[model samples]
Target: MDASSATAGRTGRATDAASRRRPLIDLADRRALLACRPDDAEVTEAGRRLKEAALLDFGIKESVVAAWLYAKCHYQIPTTAVETAAVVAGGDGTCLLLYNPGFFTEIGLGGVRFVLFHEARHLIHRHLYAEPELRADPVFTLAAEVAINHVATQRLGQGLPTREVPDGRGGVTTERVGIDPREIHRSYRADLREQGLEPLGYDDFVLTDLTIYGELRRMRNPPVPPPQLCVHLAPDGEGPALDDETVGRVVEDALTETMRAALRSGGLARDEMLGLADRSESGGERLGRMWGRLGLAALRGETQKTRRVEWWKRWLSDTLASKLREGERLVYPKKQGAVLLALGHEPMLSRRGPERTKVVVVALDTSGSMPDRVVDWLTTLVGRTDGVESHWLSFDGAVMPFVPGERVAGGGGTNFGHVVDYVEGRLEVDGKRFEETADAVIMVTDGYAPAVTPQRPDRWIWLITDGGDDWPERHDPPMACHRVTTGDS
Candidate 1:
């Protein structure tokens, strides 16, 4: 969360509306550590207060949230002085809170809770498991830090962490611990103005995980992060400090509880959490995902301005929504045997109830001609549809299972045979059935490739794009071939 800035470039989508978020911030070191020791009473008191603060403030009184520093970590060894607080991983992949109790004690209750909550968000955000490419960029790290700290500051309602420090001449004065997002943005603007370049506002500056990095790159001599803060962000980056899956699950569960508590109290935190569901693409997507899992209702409570619409989006939404709705059916109200017994005076059959769930595979012909709109539509459609378990695949010349949140790199080629080969059980790769002869297979393509036969022709849905071949429509055994008119209407 709290990482220093070194200029570099990276970015993601600027949703038509708002932005995404991250967490952490640093504070300047206070001379209070001179009295801090493993046996110091202040250390004991500080730890006790941290636990009380979380419980009284946000009800986050579990695990590291309530544990004292020593309870969860080792103090500085002779070789290392952990400046502030950090989450480190053990060999077995578990997160431990490592903090210089002296530093935490000095920050006081407000500051300590701020840092504690910030570190907690980092786990939930999965910064420790960031992609290698994202971790390699110093700018992205800084941006994440900025976005997180900004949210922390706003949510905590504390201006910033300022420590009373000892001046060299036996004088004391206030010094800020970590860099403030606004302070840094101001610095960038000053430099930009000298170069005749316009500067972005603070909101736009920390728009996404990577936005900060790109904007900072524009600055001549962008600020470097202070070493005294955000100690976890050294070269190794926020390394895997825990079993990512288990820790992530626990963190999300805790967050859900926190959100519920905040919502029950009816405050700014609740509104902010709800607003996230309607803002940036990433935030909205995350909210929608969590909503489906948690069954949290976030339906539109008000109307909004209109924006450019994608035709395929509406089509896919309606189609998938309809697929999930069950139709009326007849059933024997009594037990089957009882119904049979009653009718058996006449020897008749019993009735049944209906339940439906289907297996669906979505394949994409990701040749050079593949469109982004097409991919987005399908991803949203299948990924969010109820009652359907979906598998994604992108094929050009070879078959490959598509991983969500990853870009599908396509070569200049097309091969429907690979898809059909796997779906029909005619092909097996890596000793595994690439597919299980799914109940339905939807393939989206420009349809310029050769036609291939499917084991279940009746279940294949071919969506051909404009200005592309439609050979499936006239094939010997035609499937449902529809024209996917992907236009911005």
Candidate 2:
């Protein structure tokens, strides 16, 4: 039997291991088939070629990020399900790359690489900018396509994909190129001119995806239409269900693996990975947190001045709030008091009761490891929180009460057990006991000391410095632990 027929016969049926190992069919004819429903033979041929192109073309040096992303995706299914291609969250908590075989064949190898890279980018972009409001804007949708295509063209060195179309005469002509950011900018300029409004220059127009969307919004009438070919962007597009949670998990895992590989290789791939992290820093909270975990600032050679409100700070603040708000209740004035207040006699007040003051213990390991900047930031956050009593302790082998900006001399072995004893009211500092139970205990350390479980483990949050052992995470019952980028590492 022919290769195509043999492959077709096994399509809707399960196959043994031996059958699966057979070689894929090679297309005898490479011409684009125009039939609405191509024969099984043609479909099988197209699928085989498409698979070959992705495995061979995308795995080259030129396409580092794309190659890594494609490798991370567990499944690549070929069918007539999608018009071109799409990356969607699969039911089994993985990402699936769905493509139409005919569409892949029509665009050829260069186009296949372009489309694959484009789809991979779409997955990353979706994971980074997951804000619902951002996705809802039509301008933002167009801006994403422009930004993605722009980067793809630059990296792939393939300007754009062109498809062959039937001319009025018998011969075929090449037409229908991919989305061009420059062309869209020109349209915006023309629209602005017609409306007697000033348009941004090409450089400003294509700075970033958000910048593009913001500039497009200023136009009286947006010149560029929404992307029609993007299946994920279309509200009614058909395919497997795209789960946000699954997408986030898969993308995060893929990026983590890619970043590790780049770090080990340390070449063009590493540089490209760093660039990706820098560009995505402004995307959203999830992306920012992931980058922080990956030590983006350290890789980029950034210093203290370049640091902004990092993800760890936000996470710490939120965690403190949650811990402090526990068991708190709102107290309202009685009905009679409410009536009198309504009549302008007095104003009724509703306040959080049982709120003497929330106690927070912030212990910094001053064994010459903790960053001063982190200590300063933590002080500001804890000091500014209302109705909270703060205690600052600097500990190496022993604990000492010290205010922010007060330098405590240190050079000794680290002992987390001492800090725990003080916070749990077992040990005294300066001949005074910690009378109140701490609502939250934040420990900033290099994680060099032995792991010790606190009395109130739920209230403890550990911030381990870069290259430090995060032993708290592997304790009997893991505590909330996060790595803080020190920039030096």
Candidate 3:
């Protein structure tokens, strides 16, 4: 069916007297209301259709990123809790998309797609640019809406949500359901011109989210008010307040999972993921930092500019955390475990025991090529981590045990095989036999020596220095390798 006819059918069934009688609850009571399910069948059906159209129609066909994100959420609740729609953090460390059923019905399928896409983009925006000061600015809020809607219109081919309304002559006329960005832009242009200030052309005005925000900040009297339809944009007490950390964790998990799926699929989805990474690189520093955490820039064969060394450090810390925590399982409380045992089920327990200390071998190439700063940072990180026993080695054709921050003299050729052999208990260093099986082996080098696979290749993590070769990644059985870009180059 065509757009209008399909919308009319949904509208006809959704606008019955009973459905229209559904009371609108205050945003402050959103949590309580969302805790309960919709009683009206029409409302429930409307919610289902809205979700289906968002996932199947718009998500799969238009934006695979959306599809993966919505699928990751797993909960699209239809209720009278929210005035419009919102993506809020759940207690279980996930996110939920809550939408008002009546509002969905009023907007129809096309509007559903637009609203869903807008909400998804909001999560990403929050994830990328998460400065409290930026979010607090009303101008920034409006700019975000404009940027999101611009992408929506360009991608979904719908500028604004429209619905048929009856005229006095008994004929239907189309009326817009949401804010029009072009109208807002016109107002901004006119206001700036009246104030004798220079206004950017439309093309330059909506270039990026930050660009729009920067332009809007120059307005003496901003033409448009803050967006009222976005529940997320509502002030502190005006709507459901979400915990920033929870939202960040949820969005990060979703985006990471989406990138993994996209890479595995390797088609349009992967292209879209790469495009997103590329855009993030130019979008802003915070955004670029976020994509760096996901390690998507490396997948795109791009090196992240090291504006701050903190990003790569964080990435290495996180990677090390996972590597060190391998073979650990989540532990349930004693009481819970007993209850589950009584019910004929196995009890889940914590992954790491209280007394278990992980062993790690860190090999640094000291052939006069590795940076001193990288070694200093690694020393600090390893020293700060609890329950870890680290073995530091400085290598140059031969391996020597060295303490962090100590002066080591080495000028010989590089040999990665020597480091691997030492870690695997083959080559003894300083006439001592290394017996402990390390949980993780980290090699920081310029990747100059020949690649040698360790006894347990999976346990090895390679950090390639700037202007270095990444041969380990192209080996027969590829090892995990990451490029450390210090922005010094």
Candidate 4:
């Protein structure tokens, strides 16, 4: 064999040996990992102090969200392989924080907060289900590191931890943590000096995930760090091995709290949340839909342009909230008189309103083009809502109270007038009374038929399907109308 062939065989054998030598974690190693685990009480106590300090001082929403996310993360032992820390899917609708106790000791509380906050931000970005194309590229992995670290540095007003980091020479060296973007930028500038390549500002470089990815790709040779740079992205940076349902719950909770924090506290907190909402991806379209459900329009300051969610859904949520905000009124005369008698000052009594069942009429045009996915989503949404009684109607030219899992025949042209008539108590179907006043009426249709005015125009919601004529938009007196997407658009 040639010299090169002989060397290749030796290297292959070495690689195999190394792979075999690395111990796979099991219950036996669990004890060792636990032993190296950071003092739980100390970490917990530090977090408590941080949260309390935040509350006592000028607390921001981002800080509040950071605290909340750290609480959600389940701490675990960083396996012998992990260099410092990582956020992995806990496999139970949350992320896990696996940290090396020695590493934690090196960075101190400031670094712990930085790492914990960094992990939390990963959840917000939904990094687990990151783009496949990006995840496969080492440049993209570097981009994520740059973006996340920049945010942590800027928001926390702290620098990267100057501690023991891997030197890629099989030895640890005391230096700042991992590969940094600014350092890479400096190198890029030197390489392209007098070439008129303007380095983007630090803030602009990490503007969004795609922004950093795009800018870095322009480099003659982007700085791709060694495999051990980031534990989460190490070993080729593949996504977590978690199901969609499990990841969905975790993302939902984080996004929901983020939205709340934006509402309760504005300024930096609001901006951070706004950035998250704006940066969310839209293939399955859950992020945008969640923002719509949150009624993000309620948030003040900067506006997030455009939404991937069906227009009708946003209109429905907003209109429903308005209609149900004031529920059934209950008079308390005894309490009113007692208050007046107790105090020398006269009191004017007012009845309290307890939220009552919101009677909702959902009319589905199960015609030639009705999307089953849309129907299923609508049914599920309505069913899950608290204090909501739904009346399902399936119509083509004629209207019928359709039960789920039951087939309904539809062939002729569309007629939205029937829905209006039924809601107004002007028509009866199958001897059932239309006397029950509905709090809201939602009509999901192809909009191929003539439009009719509803008795209560304010409570009527129209969801025109794809390729359907949005007559409501051009209608003289516009009603609550929007278009529904079947996830195809």
Best by lDDT: 3
Model 3 stretches astray by more than 4 angstroms: 1-31, 34-40, 57-59, 90-94, 165-172, 196-198, 226-228, 261-266, 274-285, 303-489
Task: Using TM-score, give the best candidate's number.
Answer: 3
- lDDT values of the candidates? 0.54, 0.65, 0.67, 0.58
Residue-pair clashes per candidate: 8, 0, 5, 0
TM-score to true structure, per model: 0.46, 0.54, 0.58, 0.50
lDDT by residue (tens digit), candidate 2, 1-489 = 001111121243311222333222211111211222334666657665865676566555565666766676666666443456667675566666655565666666787787778877777777788887887677777788788887777777877776654454966577554567788888888888888888899877776677777777877777544334455455533323556788777777667655544543357567767767755677768777678666565455554353443545544654565565545621223584448545654322233547757678898888856667777667656754445678898889889888888877776888898888888889888898888888788988889977898877888998887777878878989887776766643
Extract clashing residue pairs from model 1.
Answer: 22-148, 23-148, 27-177, 28-177, 89-241, 93-242, 93-243, 344-347
Compared with the true structure, what per-residue lDDT tens digits does model 1 show for residues 245-313? 545555555544434333333354345544333222254454445643332341222222322323233
Quality of model 1 by C-alpha lDDT: 0.54
Error of 4 at 439 (Å): 19
Q: Indicate the TM-score of model 4.
A: 0.50
Error of 4 at 213 (Å): 0.7
RMSD of each: 22.8, 13.1, 11.6, 20.0
* Ranking, TM-score, top scorer first: 3, 2, 4, 1
Model 3 clash pairs are 329-351, 330-349, 330-350, 331-349, 331-350
Q: Write the per-residue lDDT of candidate 4 for residues 1-489, one digit (tens) a residue.
A: 000000001111211112333233422233554554333444434434443343233234335556655555555444333345555564456555554434454555676666666666666555434556656677776777777787777777888766543456987566676556688667666645546678777667666777777778878887767654555564642333433455456666655665654554356657766666554443236555566566566563333454233334434454555554354422224575456536642222232356646677888887857767667766755654545677888888888887666776776777888888887788888876588888778888877888787767777777877667777756767776665655454
**Tens-digit lDDT track for model 3 on 363-418?**
88888576677777676566445556779988898888888878887868999888
Error of 4 at 368 (Å): 50
